[model samples]
Target: MKKLIFFLLLLLAGFNLMAQQDGGTYRAQLPEITMDSTSSLHIISPEPIRYVDISSHAVAGDLPEENVLRLKWVPDSTGNLSSGADNLGVVTVIGQTFIAQYQLLSAAATPGSKLAASYDILPQHIRPLHLPVEISTPQLRSHALSLLARRNPSAIRTAKQYGISAELNHVYTLGDLILLDITYHNSTNLGYDIDELRFKIEDKKITKATNVQSVEIRPIWQLYPIGSFKRSYRNIYVLKKATFPASKILSVELSEKQISGRTIILKIKYRDILEADNF
Candidate 1:
């Protein structure tokens, strides 16, 4: 049941792309980003980047993947927004030179400053899953206990959708990743299992002025066993942090893993991101 999801959605290079949506004039707080192959976006500005709004277009550009490159915010490894994670950074995927435009609401860049981004393609390939020999079962249980004990929930941020309730536990931004802590609860009799789950986002609007095509966010993490009560786990283990378009109505859709038709939508407000960042 868990294996088929990788092939569920056709990774059509640039399918369902919205026409060039006007992102309006965006200011580059940091004049130049050291665009490299790695998925991290390096900005010189120290300001919080949650306010940065960006949209990517699938154009017939000079790159191999005309629709190959996509941008996402790199979430902290621990899913805690503040710990060793970046709330204000952008990361690109598929290592291609595509067109991405963004803007900051409160900051302005020096005149003639061009916003630049690049991805140096690495040896990207899907390898067989391997578990190291040094780890013991006792160690695994100890680690799980540590994750279960995480107690950071920003009292101000909380949301419930698809029978799942999430409270913003903790978030810290760093130079590399943004740490995030979230406690999830399933109110129904059905069990929560990633082997059969799916996550997607529809960009109804980016900020008050921008728009983007809908995208499927893949491979979420599960901390405890299925049907655990009020259990919280930072999804940093299996999921990479992502940058979402600063959309006004960011719809996070979750569907039953085994039964795709049974789904739920969480309308994440713009305030959700900002408030989490502020916390």
Candidate 2:
């Protein structure tokens, strides 16, 4: 009876030791990233990883926001990667689980390439995950300029509508003297007084004033239709020349209010030459 009791106690001890070894918990190990443009590489541990809390480093300046850490597999020879994500500093394992996946991006390899990665582990907040990858130079060249131009169609339409027209006659430099030769015609049969003539340059409202000199005008026909009767007036206004450092755009807008109707015309011109240095 005593021997049997001792044997049963030893069996129970062995069972407890085995259970401690298989503690029902394990951490997924980081996998080696291999460079292969033909296939995507993935590392997955059974544990669920949360990406929202991961720390990320962004390149300085105005960069395209779309390319920010969206799972890109760059070639191994592309030098220092522009951006990467840092692991969330710590990972908790409830049970035995491990999973990870890396999707590749289509880009050619330059010299000195590397794979940028982010791994989330505990204690240290964010950690940079990097792995050496091998890549081969691509044989085919791609034309990206046409693709970029196609993406921005609105700019093309605006250029076509508001671009320089052939009606511009004078070539003026920045800070140069210029003269505005404006002509106004009274197209209505009944005599009407001109209230104001407003000139706007470069989208800026310049001046609005009445005619200071006295003027007389007579209608040729009783009631002038399109080409029936005629009345014309001309004014010379002096403008100080201005220079733009680079190629600048100048827009001229004319606003006239008469007894009959109000008319407005806008003209845009590009100035490439500099006329004056002093402001």
Candidate 3:
């Protein structure tokens, strides 16, 4: 019995030793992007497009802290985050509003090297509520100069400022149309496609037909392309002037899609409502 017990203990010890020697740090998957062997920018997401078996892969979840998963800054190459092939890209994979970018600077991009092998791979931003809407640019521009300004931004309002900057430009109320001009600037070097855009009112306690029939831009609008670094978009809505009271809240809700993770609601104060020609 002693001899059998000793043999079983030796067997377990050998298995444990093998397990320690078997797995080292993960050999991270190489990014599809390639830069000037010197340096380049990238954008990625760890959310797999296809189902991944986490048991076998060393993904961002398996990694501790932000060490191996995040990008490393190479200080010797460039002065800013763009240089040194070392300054890694910032990863902000927003499902609703943004698709941030990342970077890969290769000291000398060798397939097996550490620097060139890593980059960001983001999942496709999903949006469910897409409205069927189109704009007539000719008519839109024609009405711009003559239209009565209901509300124009005195100072730029910043909606979301991390990876993307959304600014409110102008708001005009024509005879039967409301024109909204918004500029979205992408600060990240990577590109993200705007999945879905929706326009609606948040008034839930309304019991009157007057408020319902007031301003009419609902359930249909788009904000140019979310992919562009700097895009100025216009939402020409058919709207009528309701009550230009001393103050009011127009919930201008704009977002990526179903995900409420990033939503912007601009409560417009119609101080300019008094500036209308009718007044």
Q: Which candidate is the best by TM-score?
A: 3
Candidate 1: RMSD to truth? 26.7
Q: In candidate 1, what are the lDDT values of residues 1-279, reduced to their tens digit?
A: 555654454433224333244434333432223222223333321111212233322111222222233343332322333322123343222211122332311111222233344433323211122332233233434444454576654443566766777554544332222334445567766666543233445665456565556666553333344333333323422233456656534444434456534454545544554444411
Runs in model 2 with CA error above 4 Å? 1-175, 190-192, 203-230, 244-261, 266-268, 271-279
Clashing residue pairs in all predictions, respectively, total: 35, 31, 13
TM-scores for all predictions:
0.32, 0.23, 0.33
**Selected candidate, larger TM-score, 2 vs 3:** 3
Question: For model 2, what is the C-alpha lDDT against the true structure?
Answer: 0.30
lDDT of each: 0.38, 0.30, 0.41
Best by lDDT: 3
Give Cα distance to truth, residue 275, candidate 3, Å: 3.2
- Provide the global lDDT of candidate 3 against the true structure: 0.41
Better of 1 and 3 by lDDT: 3
lDDT of 2 by residue, 118-178 (tens): 3232222223234221111110001111222232222111111111111222222222334
True-structure RMSD, every candidate: 26.7, 25.4, 19.0
For model 3 the local lDDT of residue 47 reads 27
